[model samples]
Target chain A: MYDTNYHRASSVEEAVKLRSSQDEARYLSGGMTLIATMKQRLAAPSDLVDLRHVASMKGISVEGRKVRIGAGTTHAEVASSSALKSVCPAICHLAGMIGDPHVRHMGTIGGSVANNDPAADYPSAVLALNATVVTDRREIVADDYFQGMFDTALEEGELITAITFEAPEKAGYAKFPNPASRYALTGVFVAKGASGVRVAVTGAGSNGVFRATDIEIALSASWSSDFVASVAVDAGQLMEDMHATPEYRANLVKVMAKRAVAMAG
Target chain B: MAKVTLTVNGRTMSGECDDRTLLVHFIRDKLGLTGTHVGCDTTQCGACVVHMDGKSVKSCSILAVQAAGSSVTTIEGIASQGELHPVQAAFNQHHGLQCGFCTPGMVMTAVDMINRHGGQLDEVTVRHELEGNICRCTGYHNIVKAVLSANEEMHGASRQAAE
Candidate 1:
């Protein structure tokens, strides 16, 4: 890894101040992806503003149906959170399935969402659950937050403080993970709430996590596993790699959607 | 250079390293504790697993400065009074290792897994929890056995003490 300056920020204001002071500074949450990327020489920032110690950005609070998860909250914490599980177990189950125990220990929801890795688990949950991305500056709805794979609407020097969403009445997630890397080959999250039925697909989308409006429409009409399975996912917009063909990924979208619907039931 | 101070193996140690120096390198080169192995510099392999503030994490992916003021436990810290930890003893008794490259990380991960899951671990649960720790030798059959047996022994002992 290239030489860089590391500064630990104790508060959101300090974190933003420290980041702006350096020309090429990146906010370091869990460093699960950033550190690994830096080690590979793929990214080399001049400075890193560590946000793991920020007191206000590290917890899960649930009030009625609204759930707020601090950006600094680790995946492990999310997976074990009984409060979150009680309201929306699908997110907890999804959190538990990310990487392995060690990776989950250090990876954070904010970092994962901020990175917006196409294959990441949180983006699907964020999008499907209709969560709001609360930054240090303002709140952005999920639809506007995710721009594309590894891209977000977050401006330069902006920091995500928390994510808030109303717990869906029924929700479930299913992923077909790559055997070696454990990233989702294709993952689907299905949720039914006041906003109506929403289906989000991750890992397969060439443009990143996206709403499967067709599947959502089908589920909204029937709300059954059979209906989800019958919805054909178009392969044109899906990504194809060594692990799977676009057609296969398209099929996985339906299969995972079906499974998620079953799980929700 | 960055000055990082942290408690490792119950010893408060401080060292100066490059800001980018990984926690595994700090533990190995600076502190002279080489028990924590770095199998894959990439995060995929679990050969560099260690307990940071009592939770298992990939040491290779964490910078030394990021760990300052945190309590870390390496493979070298698990034994008590020259006696092997129950997990280590179980690994020895169950032939959980061959070539031994991944043992430190495997052992560390297993200790953490047992701590969290307790003695009621089943085969499937142990295998799932060992996902981060990769064992190229013995096909992980013996490693899984060692972890399960160690869980039983440790939990049984704790239960007896409570009784």
Candidate 2:
């Protein structure tokens, strides 16, 4: 489906240049999503900018209490990284649980977050962690980055370089995956940061992943499962689908939230 | 078409192909390695799993051109000099395959898991790690068994080699 001429970018600058020059140029990370979309005739780009060889686009580093993951880092790399596992086991666990072993090996954090599929696992984790996404042009907080489902604040030719997330005191992510698609039916990431407790829910909401303000407020005060149960999320903000109704999602948000809180403890 | 070079199995090969051609197609069609199968048009199926630069990946979801300058190990590349790779031997001994369509992909994925996790194979980890490769046959009972067996064999080999 991709009839485009391929350009193997040896550096980030070349990739950005190639992306900026073409109207339909796309950055190819692991190609887990882009290649499949191309095979299905869903996306046909005019130029494919290969980012795998860009030397500076891979690694894991810890600066202060934050973990910085390069955009080109694969799910498998993150899942198995000693540094990430030692500091943030929750993130490693979530990375290992994405799709499967093969997908984890090939799929990348940048691609997953960039695609921002409602069912994806990373957005909620990044959102709850209050991560900062460093792009070619600017740095955007997770809250301001994700505009909606499959939408981001990225401008044309913008490419995410790295994502840095503050280490949480205690954090957990629980996802009820769609049996067939392996996408999230309702996923919740609960984190106890230095500021306060943050709760982000994905898959059940039409706006993709978003902070559960009521639950966050309650949890921030008490940081307990019982407190989380008392705060109800309105069903109006939930997404309805063949797998689950909006009311069911509303109910799941409460249950998953409680489970996440219990897990975080 | 682009002149692409990569090491497959242990040998380096160079080929010319369209930039959009998928690695699975190149391996199956151009190279005539049919052990890798395409079960789904989408990236969902791990049936086309292979090792790219020592990590298992869904070959169907990666372009041939992207694989240029990287090392690739397909199902055909795993077994060397007529000796079956440990994962393949385990699959054979355990009767891990039913229709055998997903065997290559399953073996490729199993080897990768063993490489990462070593010999500590639990039912949960095996099931979770095998999420990418789907087997409609054997109910996945033997597939998990094969991975465990491969893990044991590799661990034994490592110990023996170290001794």
lDDT of 1 by residue, A1-265 (tens): 8889999999999999999998899999999999999998999999999998999999999999999999999999999999999999999999999999999999999999999999999999999999999999999999998999899999999999999999999999999999888899999999999899999999999999999999999999999998876777899999988888999999999999999999999
TM-score of each: 0.99, 0.96
Deviation (Å) of B81 in candidate 1:
0.7
| Candidate 2: tens digits of C-alpha lDDT, residues A1-265 | 7577899898888899999899988888888778878888899999989888876878999866789999999998888888887777778877877887777877889888888998899999889999999988899999899899999998888998899888899888888888877788998889998857888898988989899989889987888889977886899989998999999988888888888777776
Model 2: per-residue Cα lDDT over B51-139, one tens digit each: 99998888888888888878999888877789999899999999999999988889998988898776677889889778777888789
Top candidate (lDDT):
1
Listed per model in order, the count of residue pairs whose N, CA or C atoms clash below 3 Å is 0, 0
Worst 10 residues of 2 chain A by lDDT: A85-94
Who wins the DockQ comparison?
A: 1
Candidate by candidate, in order, the iRMS in Å equals 0.7, 1.2
Off by over 4 Å in 2: B160-163
The CA-based lDDT of model 1 is what?
Answer: 0.94
Query: How well does candidate 1 score on lDDT at residue A110?
Result: 98
Alpha-carbon deviation at A52 in model 1, angstroms? 0.9
- Report the error of model 2 at residue A262, Å: 2.3
